[model samples]
Target: MARSKKYFNPFKPSAGAEPPRIIGRDQVVLDFVGALEGGVGAPARLMRVTGPRGSGKTVLLTDLGSRAQDIGWNVVNITAGINMLDDLIHELSPDSSVDSLSVAGNAAIASGEAVMKVKHPNLRALMKRCCGKSKGLVITIDEVQDAPIEAMQLIAGSVQHLIREKKDISLVFAGLPMGVMDLINGKALTFLRRAQSEELDFISLIEVRLSFRDGFAVSGLILRDEQLEMMARATAGYAYLIQLIGYYVWRFADLHRARSMEVSDEDVRLGIENAMTRFHEVVHEPAISRVTKGAMEYLVAMAQEGERASTADVAKRMGREPKATSSFRRSLIQREVIQSPVRGYVEFSVPFLREYVLENADELLDRY
Candidate 1:
């Protein structure tokens, strides 16, 4: 007899990859749809989504874009970078007109006639023409923090201009908290300051449990309530981690079945351990690497404390003045690496980060 193939992994571990079902964020999705239906000048049309690395900001943007497309609206999705503005203009430009432009150079258009000149098409004019055909245009920019200020300003200016002209246009930006704050504080993009901001927070444990249960049922697996809760708690409501846990646990159960053995708590425990390792390697390590040396020192000191660290205690541990420590604290909080639960106490925003830091303390502290 041939052995059955391993159970298919339904969960997606890739960044920005949409899952079979979005567990949380139902209200935000609804609000976005409402804004699209509301037409021009809706407050929800302009939004900034901020979150940590695994908080699903990109996925949320994709979800919103999909909804917009379903209603016959044009959606332009771009990642923020040096060429973001150019890409946006190209995407919005008339297909035939854009095709006439050379790959090595831009063509100038005057009196509806093309001339050989490297120039960007007027986004405002292109958008106006687009609005004539489609219901509206939704521009979704991911990784907003990485884009240059000039690029951001250009996109924001065009969106603001179109909005004032009563054109059906919407803009959604997704980035880290610090980047979002910088964009808001830019004098040229003051309009974005008034835009709706959605900070992606941890999903509720109850919802996490329910999603797992439903996902397992669809995969022909039976997960007891206790097992579902255990999986949810292990993920701590982090979106990416939730998928990781489910993927590994499903594989574990499949392996047990292949061996003619019942899936037990041991399989769950092993799966949780595997998921934790991947989270540290994929999310925690990369996130910490980008932080400033002083900020990392502060984080290392917090890890040493093994729990929430107070401003006074961390300052003392770092042997730095409280004022100096405060600066690092604010930066980390803005990055969503840590959060202040109370007046002066700070802890890692994601569960198990402290343990990850402790395990890799030497490697992490070496940079500082």
Candidate 2:
């Protein structure tokens, strides 16, 4: 019988699986690695690694935590927010009552020794044993924007105290663009300047030259230079995009071997199509629903026009005035459903989200 064929899945990492090998981020790795290696004499002041949503900020933080562990530093990763902080602390601390307050206090104590000095006797007792001679502990926060304001305050105060006491403790906060703004604008801003601010962006040309080939090798695939360019263009050099592409490509290759006993470019093209379909199904559909469901009809209309609609354009489009539309636009911006990509252009940063809204929103677009 003729051999069957295999296909690729572009959305392989959609559910938060790590790429078997990280590619095209050497500089970021080096910078985070330096922090992990304690290049700072004391616990480096609170540092930040910021990027957009779907930019792989969480994965990078997770990777850093793993690296910190390899180097023998105490590491904590939190995403469930301040409510979970106590539990996290408890896990690291031995003498803690089940009482929430007491557990938080104890965890704080345990973490104190590992990264900063402990003030509470409970924490102090734990740290002396846990921290030993280590200079500091590493705490990494993912999706920091989701954290409650109170939690943010408490964490900021904790680190500030550590700094005041001349103890060692360092932090890594990763999140979307606004998360960076949150860190830089509020009380956290003052403390951040005292430490370090490293912006993690897409892979540079130099890094691509040095590391991209090796990364593909590790994943057991081969790509022509033109194919590489296609991926880079499609993904905009976003870290998550790289992994998403790599994963689907690997799956494609594996399937080809299983069925056809061969892999080819047509298989790659099939993978890309499947990936785009999956992207529309898995991510874009739900995002569009949540954003438009509660929004006013006019706002949904504005979103469909690519968020780049001018105030005048939006009013014209909505059969209203620029003056009336301003308030509506402001609300969308605040809710983060739409954004001004530059000073003038506005668009949905999330892939296909706006397109979905446009396709479905009646009167959002004029008949053309």
Candidate 3:
């Protein structure tokens, strides 16, 4: 038999990079594809996925677009921005380049220098023309929150008319929950509320475990049942953690290269510690920095309640009545910082956010 070759690190912990194995999102992809195959009138064609940062929204968007492409559909993938409409026009067909002419800025006269002039291609018309060349079309936009309301209006109106015409078009987008909610509630984009909405969150621990098994197997590391479970538990069912912790764990084993590629418990211990540090800097710090002082106070109060806490209890801890704190709760929920999993109870939405708060309480409180 041939020797087993050692594979390069299989985990992808970086933001927006597609992991070798996409766990727990199989159904979402299947649903998008099924809806696309169902043709124009399918309710799921216009879809939006929302989750907190590092929740795999970008990777899912790429996977969805790829699946559509596999079905012979033309895919136009873009990140929503002020120039989203122009970007779409160019992506759909670069040949539909903007008209250019030399113009004067100071006076209404021709200038010696040439200026780039956008013809402002009619996205609706351009989409229709492009559709004629393919079986169907999929436009996947990520970061919908960054998209201007005006740009959203043009795109939504075009898709609305196209759907009315029964064109085989699919519009799928992804963004953080806060931004995605704002977009859907926008007057021009309200119709998206009727579109299929998938909340990308933590993958199941079981799913993460199985993914770890397969991913680590390729790297020639031997992990026992409990060790694997430990790895999965460390991930806390968070999709991004699967990559982060796995990368560190695999890295530890690779560097040691002793004991015949067997990953010892110390490797896992060190891995978790290193991963937590990076996570604190990359994820937690930025997330906390964006919150208002009031929200920070609310978050710290919730953190004192441990992994899950009663909303009333949290309000009391903050020295406020439940009614007085309701606004903070609502805003936090909208911001994807805290989630009310059940009535009257709330918890931090991002994994380890509570710990991050508790550990850095002094610095955070002083800053806020």
TM-score of each: 0.86, 0.75, 0.87
Would you give me the overall lDDT of model 2? 0.56
Comparing 1 and 3 on lDDT, the stronger one: 3
* All candidates in order of TM-score, best leading: 3, 1, 2
Report the lDDT tens digits of candidate 2 across residue range 1-368: 98644343333365545554555545666766675554444433366766555667777777777777777777767774655556545655745543433222312221331232333333333433344445456678777777665455455556655545655556778766665676556643355545555566666544443343455545345666766566556555666555555556556666645444344676567656666666666655544343332244545555656546655665677777667666656665655556766654456656555665666566432221
Please provide, for model 1 over 126-195, each residue's C-alpha lDDT reduced to its tens digit, 9 standing for 90 to 100.
Answer: 7677777788889899999888765666567667777878999988999988778987786466778878
Please list the Cα RMSD from the true structure of every candidate, rounded to 1 decimal place.
Answer: 5.3, 6.1, 6.6
Clashing pairs in 2: 109-123, 114-137, 115-136, 115-137, 115-168
Tens-place lDDT per residue, model 3, 1-368, is 98745568889888888887788898898889899888778877999898888888998998888888898999999998766766787899887775532222211111122123557545777888777788878899999989876666656666777788888888888888878888778754566777788998688888888988888887778777888899999988887788899999889988767456788899888888888888888888877677777788889999998889998899899999899888888888877778888999999888899999998777887885
When 2 and 3 are scored with TM-score, the better candidate is 3
Candidate of highest TM-score: 3
Residue 258 of model 3, lDDT score: 49
**Candidate 3: stretches off by over 4 Å:** 1-6, 97-120, 320-331, 341-345
Q: Model 1: how far is 129 from its true place, Å?
A: 2.3
> What C-alpha lDDT does candidate 3 achieve relative to the native structure?
0.81
